[model samples]
Structure formats: structure tokens, C-alpha cells
Target: MTRSNTARRTVAALLTAGVSAVLMTAAPAHADSNDSCHPSGAMPRVGVFGNEFAPAPSDPLVRAQGWVDAGLTCSPMGSFGGYRTDAGGYAAMAWRLTESMEPSELLSTGSVTPLAGRDDLAPGDGLLNPAGFGHAVVFDHWADDAHTSYLGYEFTAAGVQHRTIPYPYFAGQGDFRPVRAAR
Candidate 1:
């Protein structure tokens, strides 16, 4: 083949490979089972009308801050992106925003990764209480230098809360586990 023709073919092949790679990595991870009653069209479309859920970035602080900046509140209308109340609602927000996966799906699919311990927790990591009732908190920062206490945002009947939480209280019985977004 002519040099020009060969070069053209090489460029086309590289471009094709690049596009394929982008599509593969850009697509959100999916699970065969999703029990959570996620709102229709909620996965991709965020912050419409009443919904305040948005995907968190890789940075731990950025993830938590997204909720604060969006003024997210725990509400029953979580699927619709309305105010989301309680830890489950917060889970819905975090799971949806971070992995584009539902919270229940994370549990069932074994996609959630366990952190070594509370000390391994990061600002944007999650403190998931999957015991009696599922709850999730977006870790913001350590309240003390020791990391024994932390400040985070959670949804509640009263509305969104940013409070200092003692590690022992939340991590009791190992129910509140530190987790990272399923990659």
C-alpha cells in the first residue's frame, strides 16, 4: 500500500480505539439487580425541579460539598430528586451520584468496598449503617485531629444536618462501615 494510504489507515485505527475506550470508561457501572425504587430517568438527569441529587467527584471533600451546595434535604421523594430525608435517602443520594448505582443494588451486588477501619475513612467516603435501617453519611472532615470524631451531612426529618459525630457511636457493632464508591 502507498505510504499516505498506510498512514491514513493507522490514524483511523487509533481514532477508533480512542473512541471505544472513552465509551467504555465513560459509561456508568450497571448491576443486574437493582431493588431500590429509583425514579425513572433519575440516573442520568440530576437537579431537575425538586430533585437535588448530583454525582460526586473523586475528591472526598467535593463529594460531600456537592450535597451542601445543592441544599439537599432528606425527603421521601428521593427518586424524583425532591428533598430526601433520613439515612436511606442519603444513601440514595450518594449511591446515585457517586456510582450511578442504587443503594440496595450496592448491597446485593457486593459492589461496595469495605475500608480497613474508621481511620481509613476519607472526606468523601461513606459511613453506611446497614444494620436496623440503612443509613449513609457523607464524610466531610475530622472534627478532631485524632479522627475519632467527624463532621458530615445527613438527611433528617428536621432537614439537612451538618454535625460532629463520634466515631464509636456511628461505628458501633461495625454496622456503620466505611465504604468507597464501586468503581
Candidate 2:
């Protein structure tokens, strides 16, 4: 299989592996340090009071695409109980689907595998910002054959967006790194 397909498989596993843990024990909500960053509201058909485990749709990609396809606005950007409980920021559509992953813990103590570069990105793989409080997104697919542009899904101040990210953005900027849930 291609690296992209391998990435997708890893992400699928990453996204599903934690559901078992979620069933075993309900993770406590440890609010983020900055209360000012807490969620201000909830997204439609998503979560309650910005609770990631609060019966929202479980698939990150599905949730993101649904919001974009329906043009639904996202909840305001806010930090919540830990990264897993975060339901209003860039990680909103994904947190519950994977283990709690703080930016600082990525690829080390966190439950993900890193890639060499963007070319390995696949649908469902995470485009994570290694710089603590930056952007997080899911790679959808390459938008162009030259690999200059790609489709990505994420939640932003405007709401859930599935748009083309072209050169000079993360693809060209190299600020974000490609990652997948560890096998």
C-alpha cells in the first residue's frame, strides 16, 4: 500500500482504539489552565457545553466534513478541560476519537506517529502544530497533481471548514507536521 493509505489505516486505528478506553472509564475533565480559553458555546449536532465525550459524532473527518458541507458554524475557540475534553477549538472534531494529546506530548508520550513530511499525509491523518497552541487539522486529499494544493478539514472561528490549502500555507510553510495515531 502507498504511504498515504498506510497513514489512513494508522489514523483509523488511532481514531477507534480509544473508544474502548472511553467505555472502560469516563475520563475526568481537567479544565485547561486558561479559563479565558474555555469554550464559549457548543456546535450544532456536536457536543454539549463543549464536552468532547458528550455523545457527539465520533468520526473526526465526518464531523468536519458535515460541518463544512452544511455550512454550520463552529463553537468559539476555547480551551476546555484537557485536550480530550476540548470541543471548541481546532481539535474539536477529533479529540474524543483519539487519546488525549497535548501539543507538548506529541510523538513522544502522546499516542501518534510522525511522518517525514507532508507528502505522506492521508485522509484522517492529523496536521498537527508542534508549537503548543497552534492549528490542528485533518488532511482530506491532495487538491492538485503537482501536490501544490490539498484539501483539509478543521474547525476555526468561522466554523468547520473543508477547503483547499495551497502552497505558502502549511504545505509550503512546514510549520505543521504530519502524524497518525500510533498502531
Candidate 3:
């Protein structure tokens, strides 16, 4: 083959390889699992309040089940206030309520109770609850409106729990919008 034709084929092959690499590394936003919930490294601990309660020590099996369901790892460590750490050694907490987690079951825990109205939740309205699957989650809804709302979750690292609340935004109106849904 001519040198020019050979070079052109080489370039085409390189481009195809590059595209494949990108696709392989790009994971979906809501793949579900501990990998999706907690990135590499360590998770952090957090605190909880109100009627919220942490998973009991004897309930490791229950907590593990919850974590698996939510795509997370449950490791019980200790308790502070009302929050408790899971076997994965991260401080976690959860609240119990019966509600619909339609659209995206991956993000929704089927226990989030909608506040009376937008006025019910303020910018720093923090909520502590057990997210099934032995995962304890803390969220603060910083914004709420007719269209949507925004909140943040507290993650753990090493043995410390840090609060990482995302900026205010919207929630799913009809179907499950996991991107917009709060913890």
C-alpha cells in the first residue's frame, strides 16, 4: 500500500482506540453500589438528630442488607448523638418513613417523606436517616421551589465524617430523576 494510505489507516485505528478507552472509563451517574456512593479512599462519619436512629449492633445483617440494596457498605463503629457507624467503618445514620421512591430505585430509599410544602424545608434543613441497606445518610435541603430542590450528603473518610452538601437545584416531577433527587 502507498505510504499515504498506510498513514491514513493508522490514524483511523488510533482514533477508534481512543474512543473505546473513553467509553470504557465513563460509568453511568447512578450505577448503584458502594463504588458509586463512596469513591476511592476512606469514608467519613456524621451526626444525626430528631427521631432519627442508627442501626443497632445486633442488626448487622439488617444493616448489611440495607447497604447492599443501596449499593453501599455498612460498617458499625460507634455512635455519636443518634448517628452510628457501619461495618465499613463509616459513621452513618438513617430515618424511618414510608414513602414512594419511584422513578429511580437506585437513589430513592422509598422512605423519604415530602415536607408539607417548599416552605417546610429551609436552606439548611438537615435530615438524618437510615437509607435501608445499612447505609446512614445525612442531607441538608438548601433550596426548594415549585420546580425543584437541592440538597447535599455527608460522606466519611478514614474515621472522620464530612458534610458535602451540593448547591440548590430541582427534583424529579414525574419520573425518577436520580440526578435531581436528594439523599
Candidates' lDDT values, in order? 0.54, 0.52, 0.35
Q: Who wins the TM-score comparison?
A: 1
Model 1: per-residue lDDT, tens digit, 80-104? 3332443454554555443333343
**Model 2 weakest 10-residue run by lDDT:** 27-36
Residues 1-183, candidate 3, lDDT per residue (tens digit)?
999999999999999999998974464332222322343444343442332344544332343334334533223333333333342222223232112111122234433444444345543223332233323333344444452534433333222232333222112211221221234
Whole-model lDDT, model 1: 0.54
The predictions' CA RMSDs to the true structure, in order, are: 16.4, 18.2, 13.9
Worst 10 residues of 1 by lDDT: 27-36
CA shift of 33, model 1, Å = 26
Candidate 2 lDDT, 1-183, residue by residue in tens:
999999999998987888866753452222122321324332222223444452356565765565556544433333333223232244534544333334435556555678777778777777666544445666778888887877876554444556776631443323666777553
Q: Which segments of candidate 2 are over 4 A away from where they belong?
A: 1-59, 69-92, 95-109, 167-174
Candidate 1 regions with alpha-carbon error over 4 angstroms: 1-60, 69-72, 78-86, 95-105, 168-174
Q: Which residue runs of candidate 3 sit more than 4 Å off their true CA positions?
A: 1-77, 81-83, 86-112, 115-120, 123-137, 140-160, 167-183
* lDDT score, candidate 3, position 163: 32
Quote the lDDT for 141 in model 2. Answer: 84
| Candidate 3, residue 83: how far the Cα is off, in Å | 4.4
